[model samples]
Target: MADQPPIPFHRGHFLFGSTFSLLRDSLGLLRQLQQQYGDQRVVRIKVGRRMITVLLKPEETKYVLQENNRNYGRGRSYKILREFLGDGLLTTDGDYWRRQRRLAQPAFHRQKLALLADTMIDEAVSWTSQLQRLDKTQPVDMSAALMEATLRIVTKTLFGSGLGDQTTRLSQALNDLNHIISQTVLNPLRLPNWVPTPANKSYINASGLVTDLITGIIRERRQSTGKHDDLLDMLLRATDEETGEGMTDAQLLSELVTLFTAGHETTAASMSWTLYLMATHPDVQARARAEALRTLGTRTRFSADDLRAMPYLTQIVNESLRLYPPAWAMSRLSLGPDQLGAYHLNADEGVLISPYLLHHDPASWPNPDQFDPNRFAPDRSADRHSYAFLPFGGGPRLCIGNQFALMEMVALLGQLLVTFELQPITSEPMLPRPLITLRSKQPIRLYLRDWPV
Candidate 1:
């Protein structure tokens, strides 16, 4: 066991080690580590008493997440997720995760997703109209607005139109939950949930509100005889092929919470960031709006096919995802001794994969910090590694809703751009803050004027 060569370690304070830097600016620290230690070797660092080996290359990420995935499982943070989100696919692993994934997979298929296209576009158009009515003199908090809009779409698409009134309540509760979860994860000094802290009490109240609302919705659906043809309907009707079984009520609750939270949050972040980029890069925004105007000419409503026709718009979405992926970092704990590229990992050691770092690697992406959506064009991306730009992750655990997210982003962006000219209120770039998802540390304020007819 001791014969294997030791992994390289980053020098830090002897006592706290790299804990302060990690707590202060993990994103910056990760980028610094990648620069100090090139892609050829794995870099190890200690935070508090725990040790994590950072994977810098695409091959290493692919190995841990795909080829030899069985040797590595989700890390400890997932337990915090399970505590809040229940045993949904995002938290559970092994056979249970597989079963959940299979049952939920069918709901997100392109064919099934097509059924909800109108709902998505309609929501975006409706939200756009609402934004148009706002006083143009004041800057709108785009981050908040996008979250609200995506929440509306997710609720309608998930539970059919019946939950329209619940969106506001759900959105508020989810916002509180996100803040609580972020504090718990990032604050090393956070107290235990059982300690009766004010934050803990708030978390409990928010969790209860969400649980009750969802439970009541599910209850009403089970009692109703009519079919709604939404995700919930499909989930309720889903049956496991092997076991000939279905998800229990508790299982349904967990999955609904997961989809409702994950479904909207990530897409909202992507849209917010993309719009920020578009506001800052007028040429790119003009090009994208031109593409949208051409394809969606004089139409108040467009089909999924219309979204498929915008290649340049799709490129913009992909590049934004590369720069600011919602799931910026993934963690896994080795189940046993394993070798990742040239380094050997001990059992129970933590492995960290940062998509943010991979996307910014100058070796893979020349002048990586620039906002060039053309980098995603077919000719340029032809030879790129599959794992190098994983915004939704890679391998079997890839986000089930990736296609759905892309379609929604394209729909929302297309709808909004055709109607409004996005103007950034400030020149400062929005900083990324790692939370339940990668989010802007501050609200993205934008002033939108009607696009010239």
Candidate 2:
């Protein structure tokens, strides 16, 4: 057997017998697998008819995400996303992704984002207004509230108009769509739009609503001569610098959907976790609140300039992302054979890297599970490798909206900390659901007591 060709480990019977088992406790299972097999172990697990290898170690993750990125494409997991995103930056590969990234670059520039900061703060105020009316004695679903807030900000920033009446309906559709994509990973059947499984039906209907909303916005923008300079306006006016060609309506629609889905959902999850952490860690919360008050004074409003000046607030956001990265696991299919540490990865094989695992790894992080924002402090920095905390990912394909997401998060959190003292409702642990993004399986509930100056 030692001289014979090595067989990839097949724990097929165990996996097949427990379809829901892996799904139910995925984070726990991945941790156990990494501990037992030491990072590079190859195990075959079925996703419909196909088998996929789940890579756990940081070294292997770096190679797949950065070193050998060319050897991999975005892979099959993003197909459903493409139905909504339509060859947008996240789903496309090679030249297509590069082109979209270039075109979309200008809108996300720091200067442009600085201008959008006013809009973001306005939306933040609108969000907190709803919470102001909530009774301090009542437990509120911070996750849902954060989702609504971030969605409003992203939509307004992207479209320059309130989503208005469509807000609740669109929010529900997005929630359903996210659920379907995550669940379908284990049951990968490529059914047509006509097929009627509850999941598939939800996906089709939700995607159609999103697509229609985007199409209407695009049509209105095309007809108007006004220059709003918002993201949608910028996208509408963008001509390929080289070819002088604008994105097709379909392409534009896809990107709008992608932005709405990727841009909002992840930010919402990150803020929810941040608030939960703040609630559980009162000292940290007090420090953050003090910092916000010191920076903003008695002002009810904060601007981008004020947000930039708040370093401690930035640390809280960074630490929250470290603990619960929104885009938790990333996968790529190898384009050519390559050497990854001690193992030989074959061309066409799928490679997976989970930030959820790497962020909590004890080897890289001291007191790995502790909620310590000071780890990000300049003087006592954790002194880890660059890829160790890739909540936004890395390389050329690093998330384009990283700056936008961070600024939005810091601005909102800073504002909230000043207005309310958050306290956790349940002592139950906040379990993570590894879907399209890392999200809390249960809504993060918090008591929002008004802060007295």
Using all chains and alpha carbons, the TM-scores for the candidates as numbered come to 0.97, 0.93
Name model 1 segments beyond 4 Å from true. 1-3, 162-165, 188-190
Best by TM-score: 1
Please give the lDDT score at residue 62 for candidate 1: 93
Task: Give a tens-digit lDDT track for model 1, residues 319-405.
Answer: 999899898887899999998777788999988999999999888899999999999999999999988899989889998888989
| C-alpha RMSD of each candidate structure in angstroms | 1.4, 2.5
lDDT of 2: 0.80
Residue 190, model 2: Cα distance from true site in angstroms: 6.0
- Report the backbone clash tally of model 1: 0
Off by over 4 Å in 2: 1-21, 39-51, 189-192
The lDDT for every candidate, in the order shown, is: 0.88, 0.80
Maximum-lDDT candidate: 1
Candidate 1, RMSD to the unseen true structure:
1.4
